[model samples]
Target chain A: DVKVTQSSRYLVKRTGEKVFLECVQDMDHENMFWYRQDPGLGLRLIYFSYDVKMKEKGDIPEGYSVSREKKERFSLILESASTNQTSMYLCATTAGPYNEQFFGPGTRLTVL
Target chain B: AQSVTQPDIHITVSEGASLELRCNYSYGATPYLFWYVQSPGQGLQLLLKYFSGDTLVQGIKGFEAEFKRSQSSFNLRKPSVHWSDAAEYFCASGYFGNEKLTFGTGTRLTIIP
Candidate 1:
């Protein structure tokens, strides 16, 4: 089974603070993705990394950046957290575009 | 652009009752369709997927879905509902070999005794 683990399950940060959400996959998948889930809006992609040091912006990538220094780890960074940035962050990894993605438990971020 | 739509926002069913969830997708060519269930505080789990071939697909936990090309729909169904089946279900669509998938808003399922 593919195991995807996130660094935190819940986090709280003050406005303008920097925040980082880390995700690691044991399967060494080549594709990693970051998504924010909101009520009535479903899961919206924030960023994705196809390979180490290669990143692409998703539909809603504003105020967010991603790092993929290694094949097993992917990190999502918020330049300066704002209240609007509060959301449930999900990380997923897949072997390829056509494969099913395995997801982490997700981190519920609260930016106050 | 590919998109998915789930008409029902929420549905309630008694235990042992039948269940069905509607899902529709808009895409130019043949698309990959998936049904995912997310339990409370858990990540999404793949219930089933529709790529090609057979229109009816069986999935885990007694769940199945049918793909109708004429209707552009992939609706999920279950013979009987269980308490554990209460969760949020999402329908997603994307082209084969595409990295991004368009997901529906999700339908929250509630099972009653």
Candidate 2:
């Protein structure tokens, strides 16, 4: 079975603070994604990495960035946390384009 | 662009009753369809997927989905509902080799006793 683990299940940060959400996959998937889920809005992609040091912006990439220094780890960074940035963040990984993605538990971020 | 749509936002069903969740898709060619379930405070889990061959596909947790090319629909169905079935269901679509999937807003299911 594939396992995806997030660094934190819940996090709280003050306004203008920097926030980092980490995700690691044991399957060594080539594609990693970051998404933020909100009520009635579904899951919106924030960023995705196809390979190490290669990143692509998704639909809602503003205020968010990503890093993929290694094959197993992907990190999401918030330059300046704000209340509007509070949402449930999810990380998913897939071995190939046609394969289904495996997801981590998710991190509920609260920016105050 | 490939996209998926779930018309119902919320659905309520009694335990042991039949359940169905609607999903539709728009794509240029044959698309990959998927149904995912997300429990409270949990990440999404793939319930089933429809790529090709059979139009009707069986999924885990006693769930199934049928793809209707004529209607551009891939609706999920379950014979009986359980209390543990309460969760948010999302419908998504993607291309053959596309890495990104277009997800529907999602339908939240509530199982009533």
Candidate 3:
């Protein structure tokens, strides 16, 4: 089965702390995405990487950054955590457009 | 810009009752529509998708959805609901194949036995 693995399932951080959430996929898919799931907001795109070292800002990329140093690994970085940034972050990978994405279990972040 | 709308924020139904979840979308071209279900604390799972061919599409877990081009709607339905079917259902649409998906606010379903 294809799996998108997230390194952390939960994390707690203080304001102004840098936090990293890692994701890896075994499918060799060319596209990887980061989204934050919130109540009444659904899942909003934060960042996505098409290929190694190539990234694009999504609708809510203001407080987030991404790293795609390897083909199978993608990382979402929080420059400085804030209370408003607390949410469930999901990572997904897919081969091409409009196709099914394999998503990781998600990481629930709490900022104090 | 392409967008999707799911008006119902929460829905409740009995285990043996029929179910229908509405979804609406706006896009310039022929859009790619999809339904995904997410259990509590879990990742989203694809329930069905419409890429063309037939307007009515069947999916796993006995869920089905019909696409109506005139109304720009893709509504999901099930003949009978099960207790385990309670979850958050999301409807999404995008113009590009294999590209980023723009999802709706999502509708949470609750099954009462």
Q: Model 2 chain B, poorest ten-residue lDDT window?
A: B93-102
Calculate each model's fnat, 2 decimals. Answer: 0.52, 0.60, 0.62
- Compose the digit string of candidate 1's lDDT tens values, residues B1-113: 77899999999999999999999999979898899999999999989988889999999999999999999999999999999999999999878778778899999999999
Task: Give interface RMSD for all predictions.
Answer: 1.2, 1.0, 1.7
Q: How well is each residue in A56-108 modelled by candidate 3, as lDDT tens digits?
A: 99999998899999999999999999999999999998756666677899999
Better of 2 and 3 by lDDT: 2
Pairs that clash in candidate 1? none
User: lDDT per residue, candidate 2, A13-106, as tens digits?
Assistant: 9999999999999997999999999999999999999999999999999999899999999999999999999999999998576858889999
The digit string of per-residue lDDT tens for model 1 on A1-110 reads 99999999999999999999999999978999999999999999999899999999999999999999999999999999999999999999975667577789999999
Candidate order by lDDT, highest to lowest?
Answer: 2, 1, 3
Candidate 2 deviant stretches above 4 angstroms: none
* Model 1 stretches with alpha carbons more than 4 Å out: none
Off by over 4 Å in 3: none
In candidate 1 the C-alpha lDDT for residue A90 amounts to: 96
Q: Is candidate 2 or candidate 3 better by TM-score?
A: 2
